[model samples]
Target chain A: MIEFSNWDILRNLLLAAQWTLLLSIAAFIGGTVVALTLTAMRLTRNVVVMRIVRVYVELFQGTPLLMQMFLCFFGLSMIGYEISAWGAAILSLTLFTSAFLVEIWRGCIDTLPKGQWEASRVLGLNFLQTLRHVILPQATKVAFAPTVGFSVQVVKGTALASVIGFVELTKAGTMLNNATFEPFKVFAFVALIYFALCYPLSLCSKYLEKKYHVAR
Target chain B: MSLVKLDQVHKYYGDFHVLKGIDLNIKVGEVVSIIGKSGSGKSTLLRCINGLEAYQQGGIAVDDKEVTSEDIQVRRLALSVGMIFQSFNLFPHLTVGENIMLAPTIVLKKSKQEAEKTARAMLEKVGLGDKFDRYPEKLSGGQQQRVAIARALAMNPKVLLCDEITSALDPELVGDVLKVLEQLAAEGMTLILVTHEMNFARDVGDRVVFMHQGKVWEEGNSKKLLSEPQTEELKQFIGAVL
Candidate 1:
């Protein structure tokens, strides 16, 4: 077995964490765009569009993130289009993140008093205008805390990308363990890095919750 | 021709009839007070005039234009008819000035400078001139309702529909809002209000309408209607509230 120094394990894990961070950012941004569209569709009051968005949300949320990663990495190749592990991980993670973000945002929208919509409508603002000027500005205040809290989930979710050979932190930890035969040491370091990455977000989310909760 | 007219208007909420075959007319610059018990459809009739709630049958006309469900037309009607609610419904995120400026800027396509100028003027008119920078949640209930009136007036509407605008105010605060309404009536702004304040109705209103079970049970000169009720429903309504 190869001898692995502490610094070496730390350096490799840190390097792998960069990919995890990149994946998390990509998934978050991509998911937000999709989620915004889905949320708008749900708000349209069109039964067909609402049902389609509901099915999309449920399909992603109902299954494990692990299964989604497998399908994206392996299932797409069988259909004819070959996708890289990086591509598959981002696609699956983005869809997974979007499903949850849509629901979170919809709840925020619903929390607004019905009067806000009526008031804006009677003020001569159209649906989109009402949403942009009146409804969304208020809803965002309510949404900030939960949205940031969910980012921690997104950060941790990057770990599942390892199963698809994306070479993120967890995958790097497993490779290091195999070479050095140090399971406990490698995983403990992995857990420490994840905690480091996620703790500040958790704190920020709580801070936002406390600050904006009064507005609700 | 009347500035506002409702002809045989009927409205329903799934099998529950809210407004049933109502006919009313208001001349320009007249203040009409609608008084009734809860579930009497007084508010529904006022709401119908602004197209805030759709009437299933009959028609409503404001400034000679029919109020329809068409989006563009409804928006155009909004320019002519402004509404105030009991809850104020001021955009909580916006400062008082911004709330007043929003419709003028967005719907009227006025320049920001012009809208703000009008907003400040409307605030002054409503006695909230110092509250231009404050948020709705930061103000007293009466101040907030006055801000709502200012917000509605900034649009330069021909008529203002006030639905129980003072119902949510504290007793001490209610007078401030009613004072603003009285001032609006004195200025000859066409005003239609659904209210429980019988004394204000008698003093400020040119006509008092008593709505019962979704119909106008009685209506006449404010003093005549309140002092002498023609129907049992009106007498009991006046008795219970007074």
Candidate 2:
């Protein structure tokens, strides 16, 4: 049996934490692109497209992230679409993050007065022009806090990737636990690291919400 | 020739009839004020001219262009028919100059220099020449409403629709907005206004239309129609608002 020192476990977990941070960043960026495309289709007011997007959102949001990760990692391989655990983890988290962000952004967009749309229409500005000039500038301000807040959830969600054999922060903790037989200390450090990453985001979200609310 | 026309236009939101056979017209450079009770579809009729709301039956035309709620047709109509709302609907993100310049620059495809030239002219026309750089939220209600007028005029529309433009303002602020409308009316700018301000209707409007329960209940010379309303609904509306 190889006995592990406290420094040894901490060092390994910190190295693995890099992968978690990278995964989170990739997922956030990917999620934003997908969510924006989905949001645009949702706004097109085409009934068929809207229904498909709605189902897509419902499918991801209604199911557990764990199941999604498992399906992406294992289900695809069974069907001969061989994907790495890293690929599957990123794909699932991006899908999950976007599903929530689209709905969050929709709420932000809907908060504007209907007169904004009506006024723009009356002025001869087309839909895209109105969105670019009048709607987005305002909606973006309202969306900022909620978007930052949702990033914290994305960061935490990376922990679930461990169940699919993608070695992130939580997987590193588990590996350290097995090597050192010190689950309590190892898991505590893992949780503390997560808090370190997420607490500032929570504070930022609260700060922004207050700032936008006051401006409104 | 009638610059704006709505022929027996009927509109419904599901089963609730909003504008039932509204027949009206405004010749070139005429000012028409529409007054009515709430839910009487006065604003809806004004909205029909700009194709803001589609009518299931009948037709609306502005400057000889067919008006429909279809996107392309409405975009074409918008160049010649401008509508301002009671809320002043000024883009809060933009300065007054930018607000007035938006439609001209984007829809008309004018150069920024040309749009600004027109915007400054419109602002000067509305007595907001000095407020060209102010934000909508930073201005008084009357000042913001003036900016909205400048925005609509920046489109160079043949007909202007004002939907209860002064109803949202403080009593002290109402006069300034009305004064701008009066100046526009005097300049032979064709205007269709849905208003609660009876004095402006009688004083500036060439014709007055009184709508009741989704119909044009009474319409005549502005002073005659308002002073001697033939219908009980018109009498009641006047009583309530005055």
Candidate 3:
């Protein structure tokens, strides 16, 4: 039987926290860019482009994040395309984040009145110019609250990456729990850390939601 | 030469005809007011001019260029034909100045500084000089509509298409906006207004177009149309209003 000290457990958990932070940032940035591309593609009149983006959105959204992680981490390895767990986790999270983000942002763009588009067109703006000068500037204000709120979900989602042997907070907690047989304390600490990170974001999101009234 | 000409202009919404075989012409600097009952294609006719609503069968020309094309001419047509709306439809995210400045900066290729100067000049013309930095929501409904008018004017349009510009305004607010339009018309800005205010229409319009059932019911001088409406529909319309 092996015993790990509290100091060792805490150190390992802190180290894992770095990867969690990294993964969240990577996923968010990657998702945002991809989500914007998807949003534009979905809005296009081109049938082929719209269908391809629709399929991409469906594939990512329909599958659970856990299944996506499994496919990226294990399924790829099974086919002899070996990749790091960090890479796998990030890939899965990016896909998951992008799908949800595209839908969320699309909803914001959708809420803008058809009159706004007509108004911009009448002002002599072509498609790109209309989006830049008129539509997006307004839609972005409409998008802000939900987008900030969605970040909390992204933070919580990072925990799932631990299942794929990624050394994040959850994986560290599990290891500590196994050694000390103190599931309650170890898990409680892990939950508290997550709450510490996520609750503020949740509160910030709530504050913005109240401030912006995006739904209203 | 006619500034705008629409020949056999037809528009449909899934077989619900919004505009039916419409034909109209106006020379440069003429002010034409299209008056109609709600859903009688006054707005639709204005929208079709700028290619905002594509007509199924029509040859619509703005400054002698056909709007139904993939060329820069359609974009060029938009540049010439500016349409205002029933709702002010100012970009809520932009300041009054930005709202006016945006088209010039993006579409007309004016530098930001140059565009801002033009925007400020237009806002001043609309009696909103002190409100350059004010957001749309910060302004009153009448003020917002004025900014929308100023925004259209900033494009330096060859023809200004107004769709019920004063319809959503309160009675008191209506006069001020109409005053601005009268001034624009006086300055020879080639105005086409879709309005419900009969007095403003008669006073400011050079020509009056009465629309009914997606067609132009009557067309004549504003004095003739208002004083002695010839058609039964026009007489009934004037009677109902009076």
The DockQ figures for the candidates are: 0.76, 0.83, 0.63
lDDT of 1 by residue, B1-242 (tens): 69998899999999999988999999999999998988999988887888777889998999999998766777888889899999999998899999999999999899999999999999999898899998888999999999999999998989999999888889999999999989989998999999999999999999999998999889999989999998988889899989
**How well docked is model 1, in DockQ terms?**
0.76
Q: Order the candidates by lDDT, highest first.
A: 1, 2, 3
Give the candidate number with the greatest lDDT.
1
lDDT at A123, model 2: 89
| Cα lDDT over the full model 3 | 0.86
lDDT of 1: 0.92
Q: Which lDDT value does model 1 have at B85?
A: 92
**Candidate 1 CAPRI category:** medium
Q: What does the lDDT read for residue A130 in candidate 1? A: 95
Q: Write candidate 3's Cα lDDT for B166-190 as tens digits.
A: 8788888988899899999899889
Residue-wise C-alpha lDDT for candidate 3, range A1-216, written one tens digit per residue: 777776777777778787878889999998999899899888776899988888998999898899999999999999999988999998999899999999998898889888787777777778888787778877887777788788878888999998989988899899888888988878877887788888887788778777777433
Clashes per candidate, residues 3 or more apart or on different chains: 0, 0, 0
In model 3, what lDDT does residue B94 have? 80
**Residue-level lDDT for A197 in candidate 2:** 88
Q: Model 3: how far is A125 from its true place, Å?
A: 2.1
Q: Is candidate 2 or candidate 3 better by lDDT?
A: 2
